[model samples]
Target: MARGRSLSGPLFLLLGLAAGITVGRRWLDVVEVRGGSMAPFLLPGDRLLVEAHSYESRRPRPGELVLAADPRTPGRELIKRVASIDDAASAAELRGDAPDSSTDSREFGAIPLSAIRWRAVFRYWPPQRAGLLGPGH
Candidate 1:
């Protein structure tokens, strides 16, 4: 008869490494919905897995929702729809041609691409709701 042995040192180390990688990828690498800035699409507490990429590489589309750092609150993240990019829509807003209740650089100022963390593709959580997020214009 043989007695069960405790976890070996090497096994414990590997387990720890795996856990760390998973946590790092989930928490540090992904973005979580924290406010109603993206309401009707994403709600607070919703989790999104952000892929590692350069924000500058991808041009902001008209209806894509993005995760950007809040200029008013440092270290805080915000999710908002990309009303427009390249200052075209902004210029239009200046001319009073945009939406009446628009949420864009006009209110928060133009944020750099580096501040963006990810482009939300879908919402997954709360069990009742989960699906691809369509363009919101």
Candidate 2:
């Protein structure tokens, strides 16, 4: 009985840790910025913490940063700000801070809402620019 009790604590801890990791991976993702599209705001190499289930309950709103599948390139993802939402079309227009460097809705037209799965909620890398991503940041 004593030996069983001692093992139970560590076993439970390990199980909990495993469960946490699984849940985290399912709902969260780390994205590394690659271009100057969002420059002056989000620079290259900036790592962002994106929430996969962010749009599960509600449609994305304007001004929010999001990660979406690139329409031009299959299997590729792009991070940009929501420029506008078209409820009638069930699509959203995305734009980067630096228009000159971005290939966004302006080039591809509005993207279907279903294509957008992740919302960029925070910046976690580089230490100095880490914080919640939103207006006035």
* Best-fitting candidate, scored by TM-score: 2
Give the TM-score (vs. native) of candidate 2. 0.81
Give a tens-digit lDDT track for model 1, residues 46-68.
86544434354655566766777
Candidate 1 lDDT for residue 9: 40
lDDT of 2 at 110: 97
RMSD of each: 11.6, 9.2
What would the per-residue lDDT of candidate 2 be over residues 1-137, giving only the tens digit for each residue? 11225556445634543564478877776779999999888989998767777689999999999888898899998888999999999999999999998999999999999988888876657767655677434
- The count of backbone overlaps in candidate 2 is 0
lDDT of each: 0.54, 0.80
TM-scores for the candidates: 0.59, 0.81
RMSD of 2: 9.2
Shift in Å, residue 23, candidate 2: 2.4
Q: Give candidate 1 regions above 4 Å deviation.
A: 1-28, 54-56, 87-104
Q: What range of 10 consecutive residues in model 2 has the weakest lDDT sum?
A: 1-10
